[model samples]
Target: MISRDCLQQSSLMAYKNVYQLLGVAFIVGLASGRALKADEDASPRIGIIGGGIGGTSTAFFLRQLYGPKLTIDVFEAQKVGGRTSLIRVNGEDYEAGGTIIHKKNIIYEFQDKGMAFTTTEDMLRAMGDDLLNMTRHTMNESLQHIGLSQRFIDEFAAAAVKDNYGQTLNAHGFLGVVSLMAVEPDLWAIQDGNKRMAELLLRESKANLIKGSVNTVALIKDNLGTGSVSYELDYTKATPGSDKETSESREYDIVVVAAPLNEGSKNKISFADFPRDVVTFKQDYHKLISMFVQGKVNTTAFDVGSQNELPAEIISIAPGCFFNSLKKMTPVSPNSKPDTPLKPEEAVWRVFFNKDPTEEEINNLFVSHSDLRLVDWWAYPEYQAGADLPPFMLYDRLYYVNAVEAAASAMETALIGGRNVALLAYNQWHGHFDKIDEVQLPSPAENEETKKSEL
Candidate 1:
């Protein structure tokens, strides 16, 4: 009913109103999208230094605790297994590093749950979580209290730890002595190598395993204005694909130092603004030399009537001998002839020495040095008797797993440390510090039952 001009004006006003509404909706949608992006960016990131048993286990446990939503990065300078590595000699891969894996541990507990056990009370009573905190007693003191004479300890227990871990019982704490008890009569190891376990952990974790040396870890305040702080990890990447490695830095909500922090280490990491106690924790290493030579033991040297009667398992040398322990690696087959001489590759011998053996000493052991395969020097750490080991958490979000090394350094302990830190970190995130030190381990018999069921 209105005029054409009025009609046109009304249409224009409607069109202008519609355009204004569209502009407001676009602005709101853009703001909401940015807010969502900011929330996504705030997702927590975890960084683990050292890809050994501790580091890999930390990554795996963190994933289990935090679910697949969180991102974890594990940085390793050398191989993934670190000291728990392997060596190849004459087509056979030998576990040249930490080879002990106890069955009576929590890793197996969680891996295989709800298994039966004989006298769970005895197993649990012996565990006595108190053993983990028994830092007041030295290994020697504990053994003495248990009525083990010094001579027996030196000959057997001390020799076992020294030859295997490069540390004497005197240098270890009560926790380390208890860890030695974690061994089973039917101790098992992966035939290929123990390094495969590290590989498995990384694969299971779905973590980004970066091949690099972490140089520094710096604490920084979060830019999200939430009054929160985070850790900045700086490292150099030299992984596969590109020949040229580049320096990279990343911000993490949490950081875990899994490797031993020896001052003289080649890959020492500087922690900026970390606690003085944690920064000044006792860190020391033992000198160990391992050699793999191909030869048979001189049966006459030990005065054995027959090579069969010779102690092929282990030959413990006297106190002043050139080597600590010599293990015969070539197992006697049923069809093997006792009189037949073994070929160079067929006969493998492993020797552990407290000090570096001279070439002449090596030549003296083997009938021929033509098949000598690998020789390695390791600066392994010893659990100090009364060392004031650091806590699992250095700061609010910064955790440590290697601090347990001062109490004990075993594959099981490493796994436990990794799990403990993961639990502590998860609890810290969820405001549940009460669950920090919680643990549930299976008995040896339960573990046996689990193994049988799996089989």
Candidate 2:
């Protein structure tokens, strides 16, 4: 005779197990079905643009869903990890881009069958009224409505947003919650660097990596009068040991654009022969500069008596501050060990700035420095409160992974978006309409009854 609380918990577990089994059944059904738009002997051809976390993770999920026979091609213009990169200072590397991962991030559960492939409307409905209303207000207003004191919002909350996004508390409430999560104690990062995740995902997916910049994507209609449509990608690759580039084109049954389609984007991929514009409204990206310096701290400047009195991390609430945050960093390599009780006087510090710091500003922060490196990045979107989120599905058989960035931008969110697009593409191709935009879950009592019936 279990207690009522224990029985309820058991029922919840049964419900989750039942949902997982249903998802497994759905996958088995897809496996038994014929491949969509492919010759009976061949598998579907998938082309993904950008080799960032979003693109690489999408390839990984597609491989898991479609099995080994599927052909996946990943195109990257620069480094594979995109914004997740590293910078070296004094012979040691530090995270220059995406730094931390929260404990609540669902990257490990990406293969779960209960996942839903959803659109913007579906996402709003799934969030329910309370969470949906938060998106319509600024972070300050949202937090205030939740009964938080104004001082906490102005100091700690503002500092979190400033340190994470280089923005103030006026950002969207949804992303503000994300920013606050970054400061949680459960946060951790990859051992060597976060970029390694992207590299490993690409390698595990067994995708052919195409090293080139895609310039244009055009719709190809009825090749050989088969009444089947495909996409043609025009790209340019640099010739080795020469100041020249070669142009090439390839066709694929499905295409995924993993990069941001913003007006300020460097990857100018134009859409050709489409009935309408692929992306109409203009979105701008925010610029962030990560400066790494190896030097002693100016204890006096921070109103501290000595190096031991200085904080390991400093977050600024003052608007006139030159930098957003300054932090003492550890080596990217997990094997390497630092001296016990780190000396702030002799350490590597990472300083984040919305703009480049002047020489005077650098001198004021540090008494002296031996080495310095700076990395400029078009990190994330310029988030606005009450802005409409972009659609994941751009057109038939075409998807955009970065559309999720409008709500929040992080390594975990990027992987989630990638998985969502992969599922969306697979479901749409195989006519699995039942799996898309599903907003309801069965009650615990119903699941318990079903569990007993099955037994």
Candidate 3:
């Protein structure tokens, strides 16, 4: 009988070989003219737009399915971490986009393997029957079903929903509230930066990582009515705050849009002749601004004597507050060598807002370059009650990972959504698509549920 250690070692080695083969297969497939043919039978050419957790995880999971011989390409306008970015101030680094990662997210599957398991209870009992379907309900209405107090609902649950999703409980849907409740007790991040996780995912995938902004994606078909579908991606190397490069085009058997489908975003990519539903989803987006400041905070404003005595890691505000939330970050160690020198009293804090704060409002919180880092991100979808979210398969052979953002905008959701798409793509490619239209990717905490139930 095979030992557990041997099985684990073999799996690790298999994954390593898969990555190495994916790189080699991509180059070879390009040279061998692996184009859109109905029955040519060759390695598929996969294209992933947006180098965030969704896109990188798509590539990673694809490698596992197609092995080392899969041809995959990942395109990023700026860096790998779409919203998960890093900013340096006063010789310290802070997350500019995605800050905290929940252990229940799909990314931390290994750690969640030991969690206390819960079986699949009745959907009505867990989240109510109304939330089970696409029919949406506000968080207030849903929490009422659970018999929560008005004060607890207003202060704690509502505050967390607003801060985490950039929308109040009254404005968000039932799924949005579930997403907030899904946050694990322990949040995790890389020591240097949270964006490093995206970088690591890309490296593990062994995909042909290209740096460019995708302008348009068009579905190309054979004039003779062949059933095969191919995609043409037109992109340019011109990124914000970078020198512009010439526009280029490429063809792939499959295309996955990993970034948020917001028309107003800087990294927004247009789809030619896309479904009307997809267009509508792309246009509807939420507005969020992430600001990083280096200065002393008025603990008096927080009704606390010192930062250590804060009630939580974050201080979220209701509708009237100037900023959505203020998160205290770990300070840079003295041993750390940053390119810039630090001021003795400057502390790094990250603030989130639905709109830009006024000069007076900014000064009220942070005294002083100390308040410079600003990012106008379209963030996620403003999921309203009864609003419909499109499927991952936007079109044939074209997957949309950010569609899940309408329900939850966590990094775990992105990774899980991407993995589901990857599985779909793999199933179609190998003709094992029994569960083609299903979302089967388990979240980090759910991995142990099935096993514990069997016991």
Candidate 4:
């Protein structure tokens, strides 16, 4: 039989080889582990847009590090927490964007900072109160076949787990790389990513949060005659298509734009206008329509095996060969489209599609005696190859912390974007680190003791 020690040793060796191949010789350790000079004396005003996971995490981390001394304010267009928000399908709350987390990640952060989490326990509770309860798989096939930025693949692939916020591009240099490999991804592949993200957001640090919309516009050159920032912010939504939502702008000593780059940071704040900031990337987003139905929607069998016993998580809203839950929805309530609208309990297994198909064809894919409901979400980035990506770069004051910036790859990207931008902003403000400094990664706490007490 295989031994755990041997497996760990093999994993480490593989990761080391990855680093060497990617030319990341500078990253000697897992994290940069650099200590930051406290910004107890400096304060900078900040502005923001988008209140997704990235933005929220950014806001959380910023407040954690600079709080009272640093006055930070945020403005979001819609609801807070962005894509990490929850959706109600059949009366149970499910993650509309990010849905999974890993245990090793929790160990990583705890070992580094002596921090613990309640959410991990909550997730574990949902999984039989055991970290090992989650299923694991190795994705050699996806990696072998997945397309990605050559530079990114080169850098990340060197690590044991190479992850890109769902970014890939064929290389003219390494074109025609065959897509054939055995896939057996373990739980760590996804969990570690999720685990680290949760730790960073719920940091032992304290943070302040504000919500609202920010209308960005164009900026004029500083014409020093009698005026300074020439273009005035459009604080009124009086016009038909004006973009600015309100006259709300708070002050912050330092603001790291966690979301995409909009015209606001460019000195354009429109009150009544249309959002015009667009990225050149092929960003496209899709609206998700989820329908939930239980109790076997149709007489035909949808799953590969019997439904006598199955994990609730298997009823996901994605496409899979065996555990596909999208098998057409059944209408349990007969109040009828003639009497009233459908309800959540009427649907059990939820399915999402980019476009709405008729109920006739959809009906053929379900088990009998099920319920149905629909939910629409502006899934990030729109579609593959960048169809709906907005300017996740609103200068350096805000971050488009949804799947849009990192693309709707996972909840981890949305969460990580927030932490990444906050660190970048903090480093720049303290003058201890540079935003582009490749090696200036977040340092592990000085030690477990120091980390625990710092909070």
Candidate 5:
């Protein structure tokens, strides 16, 4: 069996190699053939579907690559933060969706130059074979193979998956690793809410936030004999006052679908005049319910002597348990001071469940409550071991950001996916084929040798 340290070192080396190649690509500005017609007087127009982390981050990276001259439009029907959102409880806002972020997540490395110039496949390949092999097995098998004790896998590992994904050890190993990362030290979240990341990325990208849901993306042939192709998007925006939706259409040089194009997804943007189906697989998302209740702990139900005996968080492994986990929540605002010693009756708790809890079940979990709010989410992909991952490119000049969710779904992964799609688009537009789908990168030692040779 390979040592854990060896595996970590290998993954780190792989990441370094990939990033180094990307830096070189950005510096050289290599071009083989241009996909979009170059017009000095006209800047390329881009349309992005969804206003979530993936979409917003794609816009941000596109701005970084294409500069401020490009026009970008982001379409969102309801809110800017898609799955990362908030809910009100007892007149205070609390996170209802994605919460903690791992310290090692790439989100913190946003300041690194040339970090986003790679495809999803290339990025995953750079993580080394050991970590990539995790995608081919169940979490149970992968952890056991990695020399983790069964006791730890059953208790700690199970709890992590249950709490983060609302799934058991049967989940794919890659996502299980992602779940375990959540428990790592130095994990943090935004002061107000995680959704602020999306809002701020959108603002920084300077993209127009269109209030509507995109319905169709059709390939528009160049009837003017310019041999250039564009995509037309048809969307519907709610009328100002009355109960009506105004339909509108627009054309763009490139389009990025930042949301999932799966069976249960709300976005139903169809592809027209394409050579083949955009996405051939029948993918589905897992349903998770986040229930927030401001209430007292039912100590007796937990077999505890008193409320103080109960921990702030509870992870249940029993198959009969209706909920995955229960955790005490803090206010969204960092300025608000939570009462010390947290009076059991005054605390706000978030309970994750695969299904809605019955009134009796709720009563059994909590003694009393003043406010209760529930947010149902098609949270993530129904991950299956050995399942084929989706592609970053859907069609020429058309990309999908949520394809990375097939391996693991998290805020950081969403951002990574967004950056990848943006890079793929940029590379294809600028004819930088050398940077796309690169199979291997030179080792650090090789890079140093080449530098010495050049000197």
Candidate 6:
């Protein structure tokens, strides 16, 4: 079925045809944005897959670059925003997976929103006395009190200090080495530890999003005579199909791919091998389950999982499992809310566990006590090993841009990477271009299969 957006596209009418149809050219005149007929022959056709930030921004910018010299259509496999996802559940418009931004993330601070979006600094400035804590004492930004109970705070702090290295050690073979490396908590860091982890996969994990699955499936060129490319999309969450079941396709003179590297790994949706980039990911990406428990009192994050129940303010650094918990907790005392006599729903005490979790073990880990009840859970793959934007031309028109192979996986980094991909495509099409380096992610047909299941 055609979408409601049909009002947006108009069948192209030639220059003289307009005057011929209207029976007047001088009157319809030079003020019209129309170009002379000779310009028509040069218009390029372009198509895109994955309507996330990368795709959307590329379209918007492409319009700016080409004006009436080109036509572009984006073929998305899911909602408009790709990995920077979003959702509405139970009437609570909360982000599920990708969320949060730092003040240093200037790229987001200046994007389409125009208004400087909220940052960690924005929250602190809003609090009058809270500002006092920040100014009155020299404090580690990560260690600031976030409405954690003294008990939780102590536990979290102690865990952070451990030399456990947090690496999974249960591997049995060559894959085991990577599985172990992939699971190391330090690898998720934006610096030296797992610097590439953030560059390749973690960036999207930091954006505000309502997470869900999405994919792009290429099909036999629908407009082969017109030199076009298209895709068969399964938006209703259908199981993927083999060659015979494929249908539909988008057409383009050039295709710039700027989505994550997707191979046929248990974690990836695309089944074919990418034509470029041959390095294999350590393992199929793993799943991440996060428990965002909203209410708790006297339980400082540092104490929740640590041996000492110190005041939250005393912890040297924040725990990795938590997402600035103070935001989840309500400021009023638990007895103050009208109907429920709410507790600290404002503190955002949370934890992330991966595929290695034994069912009984994680259940015990998330079980909320009187001081804390597990209120929310976000389960999804911990995006890893996404490859970068491929070269400008794929068979002269097919372009690939995936984000799993960067050195740091942050939202801004992905956006920058995406911009690079879009610019590369634009230049190769006609505009001034730069030499974008080529990086290849995984593909199912050309690589080993991962053991992960959809569940």
- Give TM-scores for every candidate, taking all chains together and pairing residue i with residue i: 0.74, 0.84, 0.76, 0.51, 0.84, 0.45
Q: Which stretches of candidate 4 lie over 4 Å from their true place?
A: 1-35, 89-91, 103-142, 145-209, 217-282, 299-347, 367-371, 382-408, 433-435, 440-455
- Give residue 257's lDDT in candidate 2 (0 to 100): 94
Clashes of 3: 2
Q: Write the per-residue lDDT of candidate 1 for residues 142-182, one digit (tens) a residue.
A: 77776888875655566555555655566644644654553
Which is superior by TM-score, 3 or 4?
Answer: 3
lDDT of 6 by residue, 168-280 (tens): 21211111222223323322111111122222221222221212233444454545454344433322232456333233333445654545553433224452333443333
- Number of the candidate with higher TM-score, 2 or 6: 2
- Per-residue C-alpha lDDT of model 2 across residues 381-447, encoded as one tens digit per residue: 8877887678888777778898878778898888878888888887776767776776464567987
Worst 10 residues of 6 by lDDT: 11-20
Which stretches of candidate 6 lie above 4 Å from their native place? Answer: 1-42, 86-91, 102-246, 264-286, 297-341, 345-348, 356-395, 403-405, 431-455
Kindly give the stretch of ten consecutive residues in candidate 2 with the minimal lDDT sum.
11-20
Q: lDDT of all predictions, in order shown? A: 0.61, 0.75, 0.63, 0.36, 0.74, 0.34
Ranking by lDDT: 2, 5, 3, 1, 4, 6
Where is model 1 more than 4 Å wrong at Cα? 1-43, 106-134, 149-151, 173-184, 222-227, 239-244, 273-278, 305-307, 315-317, 330-346, 375-379, 437-455
User: Which 10-residue window in model 5 sums to the lowest lDDT?
Assistant: 11-20
TM-score of 5: 0.84
Candidate 2 Cα errors over 4 Å, as ranges:
1-42, 105-111, 118-121, 222-228, 337-344, 441-455
lDDT of candidate 4 over 1-455, digit per residue (tens): 12233222221111111111112221122123333334666655544444555655666655555655655444455455555544444444434444333222232342123121112222222223222121111122233444555443443332212111111222111111111100112222222122233334433223444444445433433334422222222222223476644454343333344444332232233322213332333323334555544445332233335443322222221211111124322222212231233343234455545456456535554535444555555444322221232433333322334322322344444544555455555655555332222222233554566778988
**What's the CA error at residue 110 for candidate 5, in Å?**
12
